[model samples]
Target: MAGEDEIEGRNREDEQMHYNSTNLSSDWPFNATNDLTNTSMAMVASSNPMNNASCSSASMIDSFCQTPPTIWDHHPTNSQTLGAFSDLNMQNNPTTSSSSLGFRKGNLLTPSWPPPNSAIKRGGMFLPPPTATPTMLPHTLSQFPADSGFIERAARLSSFSAGNFEDMINPFGNVPESSMSPYNNRPVQGQPQEGFVNGFKSTSGEGSKDLPLPVDCGTNDGSQPKNDARQGGSGFSGNNLPGESEYSEGGAGGGGGQDETSDEGLGSKKRRRSDQDSDYNQVKRSPQTPNESTKNNTEIQQKGDKNPISVANKSKHGKQISQSSDGQKEEYIHVRARRGQATNSHSLAERVRREKISERMKFLQDLVPGCSKVTGKAVMLDEIINYVQSLQRQVEFLSMKLATVNPRMDFNIEGLLAKDMGVSGTLGFGADMAMAYTQNPSQLAIMQGGIPGLGSSSSDAVRRTINSHLMAIGGVYKDPNSQVPNSWDDELHNIVQMGLNPSSTQNLGSTTPSHLKAEP
Candidate 1:
């Protein structure tokens, strides 16, 4: 009995050791049970706010170890906790999960460079969806309301899932072989096998070589000839004429030649009919004069307008010629009359005369000192008269002083004239006077014969001429005190009066004046 009991005890010890080994081998069952219990407690806590707060500390610790916290785990434990983060969350409840997560609050609140609005947080990093298509994702994203941040984020994630990203920027650089495999191999819906670049097939693809040139979508207007031309990649300048077969002309051989000939005949008839129709259309479009209407019918009957551009140019040229002829036949000068001005011929002449006088006054105003500031014409004229009188008085005073200084006047007039001429032969008046006397003794004889019509004596004429000659010799000294009476003041005054009123000369008559008489 003791031996049997020892054997059974040894077996029991072996069984106990086996059981311990199995427990050490794996803890999956305990871990699974713990996960289930934690999930059930989380669901229960989510349903009841009071219960959640009681387990808040435990939940917070469990959250760290959670592989991925559920949507319920994302919810705040109490209303106060959620209310605290309400200002930070700008989205619906689903999106508020990321904002309300206490540990993730720093990342959610801290701003990113481009803003993290387009992306979602997963494992504390922004990640995109893995199965979205490049072609249709944008349209899908567009369907969501702009204010719905959660839907926008989800659409963006779906869009990122597609492998084909035509223009997306990847700041993370080349993706790893393992992580990229799922997206790279997966086919995207509604995306072309060969990618598109600006509506053209990407030349990088091998199949692009076989692809036909893209037809212009806008040019298909149901016109057979034009459609064929556009499809052939030629505009209106195709090698074959309007109705000829392009293929038949290009190495189509003798067999197609008969068909081409028959087609050519038919083409000629069609072209003739089209030309007639175009002529009718042109005639209808253009405005027709009586002469043009008659000529157009004749032209259409003989032959349709073959060259419409040349015809248009000819018509334009004819119009220009007629306009030139009309312009030459009747020329007009445009003259605009001001608001208060008269337009009659007599008034025009009077206006011109006033303008001439005004211009002369303006010129005199510039020449006279202290006259620039005077606004009234009458005041300016008065100033000018006073200035002229002052000048005349100064000349008389200087002449009187010259006479007083040289009382005897012993200087010979002829000798002074010769000396002045010799000193400066270039002096215009002295040079001319010298040349006159020297070159023409007859003129001197004529002057000595006396002022003929005036009936003055030869001696008086000689005295007058010598005195005039002396005055012409600018710097020469003269004496009114000897030989001639002192009538210098009278002669100067008379000359100034004549200059002031030129019409007074006619009234002065042909008689020799008192100033012309020399003292005997």
Candidate 2:
């Protein structure tokens, strides 16, 4: 009976120990298999009545209790099973517990899952929740059988979450460098890694020394450079290297490439410039040797003879003067100089353009019939304006006149003038009669009374009336006394005789009048 009681007590102690070990192992990072094996051993020891009587069970129990728990146990179960168990535990306890050996707040034990979509706001991503309760998996099961589908799904979720998290953290990492700003130091696509050139380092052997250093050319405070005085008050002396001659010639020819010297030169600089000019003059004035002068004269003559107009144009654009230099005659083209005044290239261009416009204006002035010949630009412009206005008014008046004219009339004033001026044979009588009426209407009155036919008498009455109307409108008439018989009477007699002669009117049959007989 005492043995039975001892056995019961031992069993109770073993059960308590098993329970404690299980709790400890679960709390620890160790797997469930190790805890289950330990519980099985304790149960086996407690179940044996001989071990309890001999004290082996207590010793064995002590040994089992003394064994340290490992983070992961090398169980006899399949690796896939262990992996699944580990994964489930990780999911349940994302963060280590306080009782865990190296556990600390904010420290992550397992790979983190992605935050919910609500974490993103505006253009920026919001911070994730401070703490998250991991979803717990089953712990009672000693071994977990692997599920290929679940494993694959979990893997895909992990990868997708990881990639999304990476993108959120460093969004520009996958973008092409070319799409980035020029100021960004990211490497360009298709460019070799080693081909990058550092702006700080120079390509020349002298390095930075070979680089052109920026000089203090001028200041905004109106303070000039210290060396400006030495350079004859010029900011840079190099500008004058082309010399004054080039500047003068370029200005006249209206060509580019003229160097504009600084206008801030001192009085001493002006004196030096004058001295140079005098020296140039002296050099130009010296007489040439006979042979050289003859050769030069012959060349000039040949060139002048070839194209006199070209020489004349050059002289017109700019004055070319023959000067003797170093005992040799030299010709220098003289051009107007601005002299110490800063001139813009645009101003030079504008001047040339104005000159061309002036030439064109002159040509137009010559063509215009009574445009008041004027020299002043303002006066000429006023004349041109007035002339254009007058022409416009004339055009309006002529258009109104043409509109009022009878459209039924086929007669053209120009055609009439042309016909009258052309042949003087078959149509000569009509032309001559028209001219006679135009020149003197009084002459028509004299010819009217001379006609014998009834048609002629009626025509004479119409002519007298027309003449009287023309005289009323201030028409000029030649004096009857001033008219020479040879000029008027002879032509009229010939015309009358030609019309009256029988032989000349052979085609006129018997209807021809005998009272209109010629007095030959």
Task: Return the TM-score for each candidate structure.
Answer: 0.20, 0.21
Clashes of each: 2, 7
lDDT of each: 0.27, 0.25
What tens digits encode model 1's per-residue C-alpha lDDT throughout 1-520? 2222222223222322232233223222333333343334333333444325323522553443221122123233322332343321111211222222322322212233112220122111110111111111222223322222222222232233221121011200122111111111111100100001100111001001111101111111112211211211111111112212322332222212111211111111112223322432343323232343234323422221111111112233223322432232122111212323553334645777887899999989998889889999899999889888888999999999878755544333333333233222222223244445546666434432322322323435543554465456433534333423323333333333323123222212211233234212
Give the per-residue lDDT digits (tens) of candidate 2, residues 1-520.
2222223223322322332233223222222232343333323323433213123322332333321111111111111222243543322121111111011000111112111110111000000000111012223112233223222222232222221212211211122221111101111100100001100000100011111100111111111111111111010112222223333434322111111111111011112234432332233223222333233323433222111111111222111211111011111111222434313344445666777898998887886666546777787778888888899999999988877763532333222222221111111234355455446545434323222232333444433443343344222332322332233344344444434333222212211121113111
Name the lDDT of candidate 2: 0.25
Where model 1 places Cα greater than 4 Å from the true spot, the runs are 1-336, 344-346, 405-408, 412-418, 429-431, 435-520
Query: Model 2 residue 387 lDDT?
Result: 81
Highest lDDT: which candidate? 1
Error of 1 at 108 (Å): 88
- What's the true lDDT of residue 177 in model 2? 20
